[model samples]
Target: MKRSTCDICHFSIKTCVCSYVVSPKLNNKTRIIVLQHPSEVSVTKNTVRLLTLQLTSVEVYVGEKPSDFTVAQQIAKTHHCGLLYPDQNAIAVESMVSNSQTIDTLFVLDGTWKKANKIAMLNPWLNHLKKITFSALPENKYAIRKAEQSYSLSTLEACAYFLECYEKLSAEPLHHLLTGMIHEQTKFMPEDVKKRYFHEDD
Candidate 1:
């Protein structure tokens, strides 16, 4: 039987996160563009959906190749855009913030490390954009999902961090919502599993 899903958040009725989703009041003009992997569309753990719901200037495009992102490319060409990927030559986001350099749009790739790298490789045009990365990341709070790197953050977390630095605003609300979602998802897990991932004994 198909589970009844929330038309908004798309999570199953029992796991709907609509209540925790709030549109954060951003004071900056930076727009967000997410290039999501097709395989992640239906995954409950994916955080791009939360971003679309919370940010007014966010767009999400689903694809893996250059052909699939023509519209996004056009938009990027017309704006001071940057790709948020941690590459050797990527500039730290803090450097841009400190220098008062602002981008009109920011492109974020949504997928696992390998899958995101695949998307970047398939879309060679991404190489032409200014690449930005965080110099230091906060501890990962996404306990329900396992990432290849210990410092990996959920898409929502990374975006919040970027916005915090770029806009110089508090990301507490976004972090709060993320914590709620993680709590909701982990509530159904076995105690041992929760302990292993979240280090919660109770």
Candidate 2:
């Protein structure tokens, strides 16, 4: 598959989309490394790639565990390294704070449930890392895809919501830019898929 920084929504290079690119400057001490499923990288509407484009601190490792301990070691250097997932057994992101004033790292797995699980399990080193769960207020408004009703969320959705809860961050302008992009991409979805996912039942 061909790779272009181009977004399906704006048909513009990823960095050019200022709205999607301008993530709130994370705490300098906090590094976010995203382990994305290779397949997710190719999907036109996926948001992990967008986040990758926007943040310089974020490291995107394309495939399975690296041959050496380099990547895990780098992430471990941070004061904290927590996995981003909603598993009940996982500790809440908020609860992980030993000191709210200090910066820490958050490692997020970006893919479908099964895909994320495989990524986590395949790298045993990652299993020992701290885990951080989150609580969100249900801002599932993006038009590009449907959210799993009970707890599942798209990578973008999870990141945006996490930022909101922890940073008390709100970026209406950025959200507008992202939603507009989503609308642009989903505009061409087949009628059947649109009908199936366009509207969530009340």
Candidate 3:
């Protein structure tokens, strides 16, 4: 039998987190686009799915390359778009924070580190855009996901941090919502799942 999906959050009934989905007012000119891998769409723990539900203006596209996502490619071409990838050539988000240039759009990769790398490598158009990356951040509270580094943050966390520091917006609301999500998801995750991905050492 097919699982029932929540109309609001578009998550399976057993996994729907509509309760924690708050309507955040993201009235800004900068557009946030999430380029997700198709494989991530069905993952119960995917944060980008939950994130798009809360933030009204955010857009999500599924594909490994920009050519496969027409709108994302068009936006990259037409708008002053930037890629939120930490390639060696990427400029620190901190430096862009004070720059006079206005970024009308931002493209973020939504997948695991390896998966995200694959997306970046496949999308050659992305290399031409302004490569943007963040400084080291605090430990993530995404209890179900492990970080390769102490500064590794979940997709939503990175979006929130970027908005707070670069857009002069408050990340408190997003943080509050995500904290509740982690708490709920953690309660249901199997011990083995927790051990492998949420290892304290990671």
Candidate 4:
């Protein structure tokens, strides 16, 4: 049977994280545009929903094709757009900020590396934007989920960090919310299984 889910956070009611949802949305000038793969929309561990809920300037489009992103494309054309993808010529976020390069809109791909690569390949126009990347990433805090890369961060964490550095805001609220959600999720896990997947120190 399908579990009843919360209309807000979208988690199963028993595991709903609405309590951790930020009350006043975090304000920022850089508009976040998340190009989410359709497969990620229903995944329990995906963080894009939380990101959208807490940030005032966020747009999420769920699809893998160019046609699905026409609005995003238009926005990109009109704004000082930058893609949060680490390409060979990508500029570090700090460097861009230091140099006073304005990024009115940031495009973030929400998917695994393979899936993100596919999105990049399908949308050739994305390559035309200035690529932005992080130089030093903090430790991953989403302990309930596993990432293929050591440097990988959940969508929420990435956005939070980007906004922290770019907008000079604290990411603590989002980080705290994520920690609470992880704690809530671990409550239902079998002791042995939970031990294998998560550690207190992490």
Per-residue lDDT of model 1, residues 92-117, tens digit only = 88767633556778999999988999
User: By how many angstroms RMSD does model 3 differ from the true structure?
Assistant: 2.8
By summed lDDT, the worst window of 10 consecutive residues in model 4 runs over 93-102
lDDT by residue for model 3 over 1-202, one digit each (tens)? 8879889777677766778766655564568899998888888777887667667679999988657788888888888888888878887776665256558788899888888889988888888888888865655878666666666788998888777767777777677778776766666768887676565775
Ranking according to lDDT, highest score first: 4, 1, 3, 2
TM-score of 3: 0.86
RMSD of each: 2.0, 4.3, 2.8, 1.5
Per-residue lDDT over 1-202 for candidate 4, one digit per residue giving the tens place of the 0 to 100 score: 8889999888889888889877787886788999999889888888887887788889999889999999999998998999999888888876657236577899999998788889999999898899999998977878778887989989989989898888888777788778778877888888998988777575
Candidate 2 residue-wise lDDT, 66-103, digit = tens: 55346665667655667786556776655444346433
Distance from true position, residue 16, model 3, in Å? 2.7
Per-residue error at 107 for model 1, in Å? 0.3
Model 2 lDDT at residue 188: 65
Error of 3 at 139 (Å): 2.1
Alpha carbon lDDT at 147, candidate 4: 89
Best by TM-score: 4
Q: Is candidate 2 or candidate 4 better by TM-score?
A: 4
CA lDDT, every model vs. true structure: 0.84, 0.62, 0.78, 0.86
- CA lDDT, candidate 3, residue 164: 73
Model 2: worst 10 consecutive residues (lDDT sum): 7-16
Q: What RMSD does model 4 have?
A: 1.5
